[model samples]
Target chain A: MLYALMIYAEPGLDERIPQEEREGVTAEYQALLDDPRVVQAARLHPAEAATCVRVVDGRTLVSDGPFADTKEILGGLALFEADDLDEALEMAARIPAARMGGAVEVRPVVVQP
Target chain B: MLASLVGYLRDFDAAEEATQEAFTIAAERWETSGIPANPGAWLVTTARNRAIDRIRRDRTLTRKIPLLPEPEATMDEFDDPVIDTVIDHLGDTGIKDERLELIFTCCHPALPLEGQVALTLRALGGLSTADIARAFLVSEETMKRRLTRAKAKIKATGIPFAVPQADRLEQRLDAVLAVVYLIYNEGYRGRVDLGAEAIRLGQLLAVLMPEEPESRGLLALMLLHHARRRARFDGEDLVLLGDQDRTLWDLPQLEAGRAALEEAIARGGRGAYVVQAAIADLQTRDEIDWPQVAALYRRLVELTGSPVVELNRAAAVAETGDPAAALEVVDSLDLDGYLYYHSTRGELLRRLGRDDEAAAAYRRALDLATTTPERRFLTGRLEKL
Candidate 1:
């Protein structure tokens, strides 16, 4: 089964930190990506760069700064192919973001042919 | 019968249903032709035949449901001679090691504790979902869903159907033992059937895991406590330890309990269960050493770090003839609303001639006490005060 671990972290976390400290954190992410079980991983741009668009009736509406303002913003995501939820959670726990006052929400990916 | 079926058929739900079908056939056939010479073998053969038929049916359905895996392996595995050997051996001893695997899988740490308890009782204890629901005071539908979800999780996770390797055994053993003791303790509280089932499981665990001293220790602790079941009550009133009639205890069970405890101790290393069993064994004696009991409780507290153990240590301190010191120890601890703690405080206060404080403590204990005997005992103490 495949699980998508959605990483949520404090906004502006990447840019607010020192370059050396950020390198250490990036090293952990690199190690996670190197794991055999990880299918894909991507770090997102800061939430400040996010743009949300929606259609109301016939009109298209564009909004700035994520769909909703929140303390924790979507920072990254990893797609893991694991034997089970327990296996997936094991990988999720190893994500560096999980240890830095952030959280990883693991959801089963709906596989479609 | 079910274990052997599981050995042949990897799927638990299929194996369980096959065993059930085998029993139904036996029920009808035995009524007319009398009992078979080898009923176990008869059931195994019948269940195997049923499982094969089931696989054949599923194979045809696989065409309609493309998502369903082909059941050819189920039929192909039937050709293996190992299945027959396992059946023959299991028929002779009745206990199968596959059962140990099943139990461990049910109590796997990945699953929620509630799910573990529900699954263990259902799968190993042969309990109906309704029976387990009633035991836990939950709705039958809730228990059904719980069991279904747990079983589905096990299947999806592909949890291995084998005893854990030595490296993983110690960690896994703790969960298995906790589930077994949880069942036993629930049964110990007047659920005779559950208690007996727990003891049977404990005995099976001890026999299967002879190298693990904690298994033997658990069985020993349960047997010792169970031996005093008859003397634990007097016409719905809870009988305190001091008031229980020693003669009414089950002598044979006590002897077996002591022997099991001795075996655990003889194995050398002292685990929490072994220490608890040793303390229970000492309590069964005609004369107990209060200081020694206190020492054991202190060791238990160090090992478990449980507040309940500290409370028990206080009781042992009181038994050492210093109610004042015991009261001080009790005061230092925090076990609010625990009936026994309040009653213990009441007893110590009464001994010190502080009647008003003792009466207030007894009243609090009475309010918290749930069992009839406990309420009665507390009321009697309060009346005397």
Candidate 2:
């Protein structure tokens, strides 16, 4: 089964961490990408750099900030092929953001094309 | 038979439908041909064949599907007394005891609690959607949709149709035990059929998971309470435990319940249900031990941290010749909306010769009491005052 692990990082995590420590975190995340179980991985730009877009009543509405103004932002995402939810969760817990005052939300990928 | 069918089919909804169809056929055929020698084997074979037919007719043929192996005996041998032997020769997939797996899947955490209860009742209780809906006082259509959605969720999440691995077993078992006890509670409240069904489910769970002590504990708890079914009431009025005839209790069930509780204790079952069962075990004694009961209640309070258990502990403390201590415990708790809290306070106050205060507490209890029998009992106490 394939699971998409959506990593949410604490707001201002980059600023809070020392620059050298941030590189170590990035290297750890890079090491995860080399894992055979991981099919896809991406780290998004910070929430402040995000532009929200919505279609309301057939009108294209654009907003300056991310749609959800929460303490944690969508920092990264990784798709992995695992035997079950337990395996997927194991992989999710390995995400750098999960141990750095953030969380990983795992969702099973729909099997259908 | 349904469990085995689910094992072979690997699709809960499809396997259930096939089993239902087989039962319908058997019901019609058995009326004319008389009952089969080995009804279980006959049903298993028929359900298996039906499921195979379903897969063959399925629109999504692109997906790889494992074919269910046929039973060793043919349908023509149904009347033969030797059919049981033939069933025994059937391959591994023919009759796997996957009930525990099915139960865990039904009570999967991905599903809502209501869905878990409904699914357990429908699947394990052999209840129709309408019957489950009626039990829950909901419309048939609503229950049908809920069951459908629950099944879909199980499939969508790929909730494996097997017992969880050891690391996850306890967490999964908790959900399963909760559903079983929930059904028992619903049945315990005047729903005889539902209660009986819950007990049956508990027994099945205990049998399926012999290593799981909590399962046995739950079964013991339900059976012990159920043993007192006959003496629970007198005509239209509720009979207080102290006044009820002990001889009227089911001796066989009480014995079985005691043995189960003993097994739970021997197995080091310290879970909430096991603790609660131990308390129920103490209740079965001819000479009630208030101190022992109070000690068990204290353990129960620690395990659950539930205000209700603390309230029960207060009542138990009152029995140990400590009305004032019991009153203090009750006063420290905040359960004003709960009728039993006030009722216990009233009894304790009355014992201490505080009649006026006792009468006021009884009035509060009476106002909060929901059932007619409880109201009658409270009113009777007030009349004496």
Q: Judge candidate 1 against the unseen true structure and give its global Cα lDDT, from 0 to 1.
A: 0.81
Which TM-score value belongs to model 1?
A: 0.60
If you assessed candidate 2 against the hidden native complex, which CAPRI class would it receive? incorrect
Interface RMSD, in order shown: 4.0, 4.9
**Per-residue lDDT for A1-92 in model 1, tens only?**
88899999997677888999999998988988999888888889998789999999989999888876878889889889887665676788
Model 2: runs farther than 4 Å from truth?
A: A1-3, A11-39, A45-67, A79-101, A108-113, B1-102, B112-162, B367-370
Residue A10 displacement (Å), model 2: 3.9
Identify the candidate with maximal TM-score. Answer: 2
* DockQ, model 2, C-alpha based: 0.17
| TM-scores of all predicted structures | 0.60, 0.65
TM-score of chain A of 2: 0.91
Model 1 Cα displacement at B27 (Å)? 52
- TM-score, B chain, candidate 1? 0.69
Tens-digit lDDT string for candidate 1 (B1-385): 8888898998899999999999999999999999999999999999999999989987777656756652332211212133234434533555655557767777887678888988877665656677678767688878877776676666555554566666667668878888888788767777767787788878988876788899999999999999998898887777877889999999999999999998998887498999899889888888988899999999999999988889899889989998899899888878875888899999999998999999999999999876677788899899998
Q: What residue runs in model 1 are displaced by over 4 Å at the alpha carbon?
A: A1-109, B1-99, B114-166
Q: Can you give the DockQ of every candidate in the order shown?
A: 0.17, 0.17
